[model samples]
Target: MLELKEITKIIGDKIILRNFSLALAPGESVAVIGPNGAGKSTFFKLAAGLMQPTSGEILLNGEQIKKKTHLLKKRIGYLGHESFLYSALTPLENLRFYGKLYKVKNIEEKGMELLKAVGLHYFKDIPIRSFSRGMIQRLAIARVLLTEPDFLLLDEPHTGLDQEAVSLLNLLIKERQEKGIAILLISHDFEQVIQVCERVLILNKGRVVEDKSIDHQRGLMPFKNWYEAAVSGK
Candidate 1:
């Protein structure tokens, strides 16, 4: 459903991504693991069309995304590190605003349903500025889901989430996968990555250095060991 071909991003004298390429099939989920400054977030931005690559191409559903950014916007959902919510807006109001932006059908109904899914229905009328970090993150998830996007790009989605909230996230991702939404995520939590992703890509110094499938039978420790080894250059 999404493909990045030889994508390169350079800023002044620094290269953020070097010929990075990846393909995510419909309903498939992939996780990106890397240390700080490894370009994971940059990859997410390029995939979401928030930034353009210095070279190469990004495609969605067989169309070049750079050439059809508007259409691409309609098909992808992105969750950055920040909640990006309006401090003065309540959960309901925030969803209502974004729902309209996405031209979602039954906006009110959808907005309410999403708030409920994220456990924010009770706080629907309360201003977001008073919310806890996890609460705001939950609301952000609701905001992203309002569009029912075909491709989901998440950067550090587990940040600020408690155990229950993380479980909720896992459940949501499983549901999206069942419905054929492609997911691309950047996460430091190996457990979450193992739970939701079939494949893992390790990025270092602006390039993908390791790409491998998760062997569920091997359990968590082995995967953790592998990731540690990869990142530590073992």
Candidate 2:
């Protein structure tokens, strides 16, 4: 459902991404892991059409993303490292605003459902400025779900989340995957990554050095071993 072909991104004199490529099929969940400065966020920005690659192209479905942004925006949901919430707006107001932007049907009902799902129903009328980091994160998740996107790009979505919020995040990921949403997420939480994604891609120095499928039967040990080996150049 999403494809990046031979993408290279350079900023100033430094290269951030070099000939990077990846594809996500419908209903598939992929996790990207790497050390700091591995260009994971840059890759997400390229895919989301928030920034252009110096070379290569990003496609959603069959159309090039840069050339079809307006049409593609409705089909994709992106959650970045920051919550990007309007602090002055109430949770209900925030969802209603985005829901209207996406032209979502029954926005009021849908907004309430999402607020409840993210455990923010009680705070629906409260402005986000008073919320704690985790609460804002939960409300952000609710905001992203307002459009029911077909493709999800999440960058460190687990940031500021507690164990309960993380559990809710996992459940939402599973539900979206079951509904045939294509997902690409960057995360350092190995345990949660194992629970949510079917495949893992290890990016190093702007390149995908290893792509491995999770072996659920063997558990996290195998993934840890593989990641260590890959990063250590084993």
Candidate 3:
């Protein structure tokens, strides 16, 4: 559903990504783990069509992503460092606003459904400024899922979420994965990585240093050990 072909991005003189290539298929989830200067954020932006690559190209459904930003907004669900929500608006109001932008049918019903899924139905009318960090994160997730996006680009999605909230987010991710949504994740939580992703790639210095398919039987320890070693240069 998504492809990044030999992509590279340069900002001023610093190179952020180098010859990065990836293809995501329906129902597959991939995790990217790397150190601070590893360009994971750049990779996510490029894939989401939020940033243009200095070289190479990104494609979605066989079309150049840059040319179809409207399609990108509809097909991609992105949760990034920014919440992209209104602090003064109630959760329902925020959802309704975005739902209208996405042109989702039955906006009110869909807003309530996703709010309930995120355990924020009771706070549906509460203004976002009064919420806690975890509450805001949950509402952000609800906003992302409201459109039933085809591909989810989640960057540290568990941020500020409590244990229960984390589990709830995983449950939602798993459900969507089952329904054939391709997922691309950048995260550090071992359990979240193991539970939802089928493949993990270790990126560093703008390149893929290690890429391995998850072996569910081996458990998180083995993969954790591998990740530690690969990026630690062990």
lDDT of 2 by residue, 1-234 (tens): 788899999999889999998988999999999988999999988777788789998887777877677666788888998887899999999999999998999999999999988889998889999999889988888888889998898999997788998999989889988999988889998888888888999999898999978887778888888898898888
Q: Give me the runs in candidate 1 sitting further than 4 Å from their true place.
A: none
Per-residue alpha-carbon lDDT of candidate 3 for residues 1-234, written as tens digits (9 for 90 to 100): 788899989998999899999989999999999988899999988777787789898888888877677887689999997778999999999999999988999999988888888989998888899998888988898899998899999999987789888888899999999999999999988778888899999998999999888888888788878887898887
Judge candidate 3 at residue 153 and give its lDDT.
Answer: 92
C-alpha lDDT values of all predictions? 0.89, 0.88, 0.89
TM-score of each: 0.96, 0.96, 0.96
Candidate 1 per-residue lDDT, tens place, 61-144, comes to: 778877678788888999999988999989899888888889999989988888888888898899999999989988898888
Worst 10 residues of 3 by lDDT: 65-74
In candidate 1, where is summed lDDT lowest over 10 consecutive residues?
A: 61-70
Off-target runs (Cα >4 Å) in candidate 3 are none
Which pairs clash inside model 3?
A: none
Model 2's TM-score against the true structure = 0.96
Q: Candidate 2: global Cα-lDDT? A: 0.88
Off by over 4 Å in 2: none
